[model samples]
Target: MKNKIFFLSCFILLSLTSFSQSISSSPYSLYGVGSLYDSDFGAIPSMGSSGIALTPSNFINNLNPASLGFMPLNHFMLDVGGKAIATTYQSSSKSEKRNNFQFSHFAFAFPVTKKSGFSVSLRPYSSASYKISDLKLPILDSNESYYLTAGGTGGLNNFDFSYGYRFTDKFTLGISTALLFGNVDDNRTFTILNSITNIHKKTDYNGFRATIGSQYKIDSTFTIGTTIKLPTQIKSSKVQTVETVADEVLSVIESNTPSDVDDYYMPLEIGVGISKKFKKALTVNFDYQKSLWNDTRQSDLYGDFVNQDRFALGFAYLDEKSNFRKYWDRIQYFAGANFDTGYLEIDGKRVNNASVSVGINLPIENSLSSLNISYSYGQKGRISEGLIKENYHKLSLNLSLDGIWFVKRKIE
Candidate 1:
């Protein structure tokens, strides 16, 4: 109880010390919020990635309780998923970059109530990990040149807890909540073509999150589910920022006092899905979801104006003689497709994008564990009517461990 109180107190203290401010600044992009939470599940050609509203039969979604209804009885679930990426910039000769190990997430789940369960998970909310360096044309009014190199990593390390109850043999209700311990660390080097200054800032914000959803069996052959997510608020903090004036020299600004000003809101997300059983051993699932991104606002630095709406379809089948490992055979394959259009507008202009993803379940450790790998590639274009696009590729691998942990005793 004392430890609990201490952690809570620490969170509250951080909440009261941070404030968010965006002056016309390039490092401002560091303040850019929201894009890092996109979960593509690593399947690119079929189920489009990008946090679209869909759930395939995978282990990671349990971070939000809406995903727990899919687990089986006597089940103990464990998951670790990570990504590798190769990013290329096509417009500028100096734009090429690579981040082989980009992001990762971990999760665990187990039964708590009859036909009900609970779980916890942690994952990167939005990655501040990036580098930006560009030279501007001569300032018409000033004789100075602008060159800034800055980047940061970390945001909203989320911890989730959830409970799911079976209301009937065919229906289940799920409610899950999350507590985020956010830290965005940054370092910047600024220059006016000669003089340079380097500064760093680390800010922490703590907040609460929640999601409510339910699943129902339409018949012996099909099932469906939906969830409504509540918005999460990250307490304010004074993060490091740069302010550019007509003089062209970059400068760091701080609050006159320790101010609780920075606040981040993860918009409400709503989603629905359905699964059909084609045979005793074959089944298919499909889902659609929309996140309230338009309802969220951004600072000049957090440029992802695109909140997302997504769609997906996944399938599972039992293998020959059920020899694929009882657990591994339960998930034969998964495929999906997604579409994305963000809320980012450049003076009354908006651009749209889409993609596909696919993955397979490879059984491991006598079926007690399995390795699921997925790959995705996509493009979002029409940047501010300049037709700028970010064509990207991502590969992901997730390991799932599921089995029985305890057994109840009976007496005559």
Candidate 2:
């Protein structure tokens, strides 16, 4: 079991190092640093990404790191997963479709003591991939027209570490530190009378991020959790190049060496959640999250970064009285839904998004391992606001493993 865990870890690290590129292709990603990546993993994805207040059990909950303090002593857990996405974009008169597949998340957690724990993980911070070429304008007072084309790719990555300590059987606190780094590439081209000019820009990012979390048990059946992510800026360098195109041939006309740009701002975020258990047969969770983007004083060229909020409700159920001999009877079923007022303000309206999800956990034959699968259908933006609308379907898979890391052995 240990060997298998080690192998999986190495494979994920190698894959991440070898394939570094954008994982999404939505036009909404063109704003700010790009569309933000989901921060939850494991069965939580099936549960509307809302497990912040749940006590740790077979799976590790990273949504609220403080929950780690409840892990069983000497227990080690690991989760690795990925997702596949298909999306269709629609405007007032046209539509396009795109597909993508990419690694989702990787994490490892271990208990330091009966009341303390630690964990580490690697997850995507954001993604940027888009192409636009539908603009045409008549040359001033001339019978000629020009076209504008724009596209971008690349994103940011986050490496995080967390530690949690239990103050009592009912309360826990945790802190997390993250190293953020990545790069983004943006390009634009203008064409007129068979002549084309292109401008390309690249930005490299590096920064540190921090967060704090806490959880308090209100009763045997209810618990409350909260988290706060502090605002920080990412130091970056930008490189620009200009090229001229004629007769299908291109030549670089000018270029700017990479130079430092004013650091980009990241907004503060806060989240709160609650979990309720009903006699072990069913559990329900509710979560609310907010990003204070309006206070960041940052604005995109085409839109404003406004305050963002999300609400989610989740449920899990199992037949506790079912025979253990039946594999299907022992399985857990989960379902959820979420709604969001997105961070981008375009055409005087904030982009809105919503999704519904369902999933199940399949237990391994003779090991403390389970395979989790989830599916979600979502939509973003509205066609009535002079904006593009996006509809997407996503599939996610995760392998959750539990084992003992070390113990004393006795021999005769």
Candidate 3:
């Protein structure tokens, strides 16, 4: 039975992987590598993406690797998730709507010993899919303006391996290593007066990064955790073609020219979180994270990089002593909220985001397997001159399944 389940899961995972490309369509994705993705696993999406101090005894926790230290003995776990998003883009002149389906993440974990665990996961790191048409911009140092049309596709993917060890009953430490790789293709058309120019480029990137985390239990009901993400540079190379049309005559300036480009720098990040339990029925989690984007000294053509701050809070409830005959009584309910002071600043205005989510976990049969469903409503950016605002509704579904290993069955 276990072998059948594993093979079935592998088949589904491959199917989803083929359709996971182009998960984002935000105009904001035109900047940097693209819009960063949130591929939180299991119930983490329902918890406002907050779970730094949580243990992975019930579900895998991607925010902090230390959570794996508490994995139940002799248990193997697998988690897969996906999302559907509907968004409305609003500007001063018009509004547009788009919908997308995203393959969120896939992971599996197992215990190495009584006090240690390890996991491996694969997920998208960013999305570079966007489209813009006839955007007018003033030419620098001139009274003239130009019309610009741009489109891009492709993004980065993250493959990570993590390990956690419990040194004592009250403390755990963990480490993670990630490989980031992908490519982006962009095409742009510029119209200045009667002259037209076109540029098409494809850039490839690859890099490695590391993270360290620690968790400590203050008491039976309280826990605290911290994590540090080291900065790294992504190596980049590009092939570009540039052409121009003058007096209705087309001329090629560069044809498939390959060259080295500036390497992209990822900023250092730090995070802290706390988890508290009230009796056995309710749990609360709060987390704060900071990214030093300004310190990286990275500048975009249309925006400035600034320090970023994020906060998340979540609540979960379940009835531990409810009647066993009532299925609803065994279900877990969750609610959460998140706020982010974005790292990109355009026209002296910061692009920010805020969101709230609610969800439930439904158990399957009598095993440690369940389905997680969540809904989120959020807003990003703001309506202003040359700015677009996004209002989105997202639905997430995650399946978590666990199987017992290395245990003898009494009857077989």
Point to the candidate with the largest lDDT: 3
Give the per-residue Cα lDDT of candidate 1 at 79.
70
Candidate 3 segments whose C-alpha is farther than 4 A from its true place: 1-18
Ranking by lDDT: 3, 2, 1
Better of 2 and 3 by lDDT: 3
**Residue-wise C-alpha lDDT for candidate 1, range 57-97, written one tens digit per residue:** 43545423544655666778777655655555444343455
On lDDT, the stronger of 1 and 2 is 2
For residues 1-412, write the lDDT of model 2, one tens digit per residue: 4356445645644554344353878787777777888847778889988887887577778788898898888889998777778999998888998887777778999999889999999989999888888566557798988887889988889999999899999999999999989888999888987899998889888999899999999888899999999999988889988899999998987787665566778889999999998977799999999999988998886789899999999999887778877877878999999999999997698898999999988776555567677898999998864478999998877778888767777774
Where's the lowest-lDDT run of ten residues in candidate 3?
A: 1-10
Note the Cα lDDT for every prediction shown: 0.57, 0.84, 0.89
Per-model TM-score on C-alpha atoms: 0.73, 0.89, 0.95
Per-residue lDDT of candidate 3, residues 1-412 (tens digit): 4355445545554555566764968988898899899999888889898989987467889999988888899999999987888999999999999988789998999998899899999999999989999999889999999999999999999999999999999899999999999999999999999999999999999999999999999998899999999999999999999999989999999999997688888999999999998978899999999999998898887788899999999888986778856767778999999999998998899999999999998776566777778999999999998789999999887888889999999999
Candidate 2: misplaced stretches above 4 Å? 1-22, 136-147, 191-196, 244-253, 384-386, 408-412
Model 3 accuracy (lDDT, Cα): 0.89
* True-vs-predicted CA distance for residue 30, candidate 2, Å: 1.4
Which pairs clash in model 3?
Answer: none
**TM-score, cand. 2:** 0.89
Superposed by TM-score, candidate 3 places the C-alpha of residue 124 at a distance from the truth, in angstroms, of 0.3
Q: How many residue pairs in model 3 have overlapping backbones?
A: 0
Task: Indicate which candidate wins on TM-score.
Answer: 3
